[model samples]
Target chain A: MCRTGPSPDPPEGGETTSTDAAFTALLEDSADELYESAPCGYLSTLMDGTIAKINTTLLTWLGRSREEVVGRMRFTDLLTVGGKIYHDTHFAPLLSMQGSVSGIALDIKKAEGGRLPVLLSSVTKNDSTGRPQLIRTTVFDASDRRAYERELLRERQVAEAARTQAEEDRERLQEALAVLQQSLLPAALPPVPGMEAASHYHTASPDRLGGDFYDLFPLDGKRWAFFLGDVCGKGPQAAAVTSLTRYTLRAAALHDPDPVAALTTLNTVLHERYAAGDPRYCTAIFGVLEQAGDTVKVELASGGHPPALVMRQDGSAEYLPTPGGLLVGILPSAPFTATTTELAAGDTLLLYTDGLTEARIGEERELFGDVALRDFAADLTHTAPHEVIEAMTGLLNSFGDGLDDDTALLALGVPTDRPDTGSDSPT
Target chain B: MDIVSRNNVTVTGPQDAPVLLLAHGFGCDQNMWRLVAPALAENYRVIQFDYVGSGRSDLSAWDATRYATLDGYAQDVVEICEALDLREVSFVGHSVSSMVGVLAAAATPDRITSLIMIGPSPCYVDSPGYRGGFSAEDIDELLESLDSNYLGWSATMAPVIMGNPDRPELGEELTNSFCATDPAIARVFARATFLSDSRDDLKTVNVPTLVLECSQDVIAPREVGAYVHDVIPGSRLVTLDATGHCPQLSAPEATLAALTEFIGNQS
Candidate 1:
């Protein structure tokens, strides 16, 4: 340290220089000890954003020389375009208003033109008269913070993309499952000349591909055959059984149109294929559609499936007379029973998968059972094919997401004598 | 009455490849550019639209008489530009749409920025001097095949469509996409599309041009693209390293890089 007066003895320590050694040591140590090893970057800025003073810590962090930043650049010049906007809009305003702001975060654009994120707290210094002197600030390196935020954003984007892809995959699977379930049944119901028929396969789960199927196909000269069945179990194994049942039933019907004989043949075939310990079986009702002028005959046979519901034109409803039949394919050649009923004009025959009657609605977990379905059928007997479908579909929809299986439906009815015969089916 | 739809136009980008108006080819709507549009969006205000009788555009606006000639499609391009208040447009055209762009560019030379054609051809017939690859007899056979076979699924084009799709069943979606077309009208459109000669008007395209040629394309030959390139003055030809009739489908990244560099350089 140099002073205007003559050199003095070093603070009475014998081996001396003529100065205050303590003050000299403090001045010398300030540059290397405090500036280089300071907690953060230190700088002084002019009121108009020019840089006046900077420390070695900041200089080293920015990879620049002392001459390059101080006097040559302003604090705003050190900011990137975005950083500058933040400085002008928020930092400068808040600092000017308060006369001092601290712990603020900003990026000091490096001399290399790349971004250098920093936490910069600043204060306006005062002169003796309390007039504003210069702006003083300390900058903490925020590279890790910026990188972390960028990674967080990238991760969020990837998660969002993955979520979208999963949703698409799930939707595609549902559509595929729907189409597979549909293919197990007929493409569309065969039009009968003298009767109305409606069928619904209530699904318990959308995710699980169920093993229930229904179809109304034209049989020979004046007959149409329809059937509804529930294959045992769930998932892919059940799907396979459903596929086998569909093809075998069609083949059996072609061999012999008699309902009992068709059921017997299917029983024997299933028994032969899956009589092992890991055996499988299903319940079914097959019927031959017969036209008798204004009346139709449904000679149906049962193999442990639910009985057909007969809703008369007179608004009367009853279960068809089907009794004493075992489940097909469970036993080796199980016996099936046949029953016949006459369906007069405006009469409807309801056929459905077991999911409709087996659904659990109340707190007791009691089955929905046959009575509710019968009542539902009684109300919808006079409605057209579409109305019947809509009513039944509404009932199933009321079940909500509770119905977890796949569903298939087919509806047919003899048209009423109106000028417009082409009334499209109901929603 | 010519029955065609006139909706589904979207404008997005830098507001700056100037305005590049794009028209899709036959049998598809504007959704064909889903993969490549985002890249072009960075530099150019690219416009994409659906032509009636295809895609999700309104079919009710189709008028048979007005749409009978190529001039009607040209008028639609001009009308859309005027409606959106677009000027100095860079028009991009695909197969059937290339000729439509040519006709539109000719009508309003001042409004066009450039013409960028992807998979363009003048005619489908085998002339005395020129070979468009398909003969008149071949095109007829193709049309007949379309009547019988196009109704079912085409595996390549299936996923590209976001709307009704034809699968192995050939029922509902088939009726919507292929069966919706009147066989007679489609046949007429096909004939008009394949038989037209637009080489005479190529020289008259005075705007700055860019021809994006897809390599190994069966529909639009490289030679044909070169022939068109020679006719248009001061036009830059960029041959993309890709195969198939659709570059936006087969190679999106390469197409994006090229368009970005070219548009940036030009700007």
Candidate 2:
């Protein structure tokens, strides 16, 4: 019986004979025969890498006889030049110190011209005295593995290149958007004769182009025209509307220096250009400043825009309201409200878009509102146009993430004392 | 930067003896000298360090722009000498590091006294009237080899290469982490080692130098070794009875004998 002295015997006699025959076949395979014909190549080398003995499987892969490889060639001679260098630099040093190395990939030069990729493992065999005498190595054919690894490396390189390209493209687009956004606004405010003028613009995000724009340019030798406004939305579409509005107002003011006529011209152009299914609109304050004796006379027209604030030299602040102004570009004939004021010495007039008053503040998400802005301006000690604009800029920055929209600001004032030169000079 | 920790410097042997600075080549770290370091340490103070981006050195200290050229490696050597306040030291450099030792010696003339170059080839690519034993295509093949090896380095191999202290069984099975460099860092080092041309700097060597060449090295052949010896005036060239490029590992006894003889003669 195959069980050899078992208490219980099998019920099937046919199965026992088959099992016994299989065991007999397995036991017939000798260790020496298995070593020579193993699937992997095996070899034994001296401490200095001299090939002392090698199996027939390794010899067959090398395509050389045992006489040529054993004792005639060192282990390095079997490797490709590149693999040899890698062995000397990386593999040899590790094996010597660690006493064993596993899964090191290298290329072996075949007898005929091609190369065989292999994964090699070697272990040092020590004598009874613990002195290293021989090295036992096993080599596995890794042609398929190496080919797969090469494919992976190539894919990795391509992915890295694509990522770098995408990053560069994103940076270039941002730069181009920034340049286009700057073109919609004035480079600088022209110097107003016998007055001081200052302006600031803040964008909510760098990626999306801001729709807020402002400019102050001389209409003639005596009077200066200025406008500050915000379009309905952000990005390229709103920027286009802002550009059309800015040029229309500038051209219309040259034709007629009256504030009402300049804004009316902008209204007509915007209503006609964006008159299709998707309508575009903006809120704007167009004004004119002229030297009237010692004070500057300011006349302004608003198209559903926020009322301008006047910070007086006597520590008083109030909004010069023009009520019932219709939103521009809603109809062919939109009614705009008109107002007039005089800026005395040390008095400043500030115009801003709704972004400042509509900004969210605190945990309650409460709006900053027009009343808070008036109080903030009244608390300021300096009434100069540049000082007012600077304080307003600081207030806007303090809002931080609370300010989620584009804001534009413009300030015009009369100086306390006249300068020696009557020529136009920027503040 | 704490230069000791940054470069993974390890000092052994007598504190009062003359210092021997051992520098490893590309594709390896300070562990390359493990076999030969003990023999040299018997009389000299042995100093071994891994280059930044090579071994257990502080990888955060590695800057691509700084280490892009051989001069950056030389700066590491100079800073190590300055940090230890060492003088009259013997520099033993293997492979690409041999050129680095030349640069470090020139930068600080009084600090490094002698240079021992083992299997050094200044230029790996062959040009007009020069034999560096490798063609440009062969170097590209070497780079491809590195890339292939890196693919196998990620999952199952990383822990084995970098010792696994968590499993004591695997820990004992762990080999030296000489080649356990970050793949990106290894790519840069491979490019620097193979694509560089350092032939002109050999003439600037003023220290007593020893050019040790293996009798049969696939990387640095006899012609390249002879070229290095001929360029440097008053340099000694000894052909060791070795097989591979790393004589220190393949023939440690012969490597030690040549090094000790050279160092003893300097004294």
Scored on chain A only, each candidate's TM-score is 0.74, 0.84
Tell me each candidate's TM-score: 0.51, 0.85
Candidate 1 lDDT by residue in tens digits, A1-427: 5555655543457445444666676777755688667978999987655689998889887878988888887786676533443343235544554566554455565666666677678899888997667899889987787577657656966997999999999999999988887777666565566655556666666687788888777778898888888888888888888888888888889889999888888888888888776688989999887887777777989999888777665667788857889998988767788998877666667777767777667667677779988887877655666677788798878766555555555554554555243353212
Per-residue lDDT tens digits for candidate 2, residues A1-427, read 2445653544468777787768767776778888999999999998677899999999999999999989988898898767776777777777777788888888888898799999999999999999888999999999999899878888988999999999999999999998898888887887777888899998888999888888899888888999888899888899899889888989999999888888888889889998985799988899998888988899999989999999886668899998888777878888889999999887888999988999999999899999999889887534578888889999999998999998999988887774234253322
Worst 10 residues of 1 chain B by lDDT: B171-180
Q: What value of lDDT does candidate 1 attain over all alpha carbons?
A: 0.69
**lDDT measured at residue A309 in model 2 versus the true structure, 0 to 100:** 92
Q: Counting only residues 3 or more apart in sequence or on different chains, how many pairs clash (N, Cα, C under 3 Å) in candidate 1?
A: 20
Q: In candidate 2 chain B, where is summed lDDT lowest over 10 consecutive residues?
A: B151-160
Clashes of 2: 0
Candidate DockQ scores, in order: 0.02, 0.50
Task: Report the CAPRI category for model 2.
Answer: medium
Off-target runs (Cα >4 Å) in candidate 2 are A1-14, A187-200, A220-223, A290-296, A344-348, A383-401, A410-427, B1-21, B35-48, B57-68, B75-89, B107-113, B151-177, B251-257, B260-267
- Model 1 alpha-carbon miss at residue B154, Å: 45
True contacts kept of 2: 0.55
Question: How high is each candidate's interface RMSD, in Å?
Answer: 28.3, 2.1
Q: Which structure among the candidates has the greatest lDDT?
A: 2
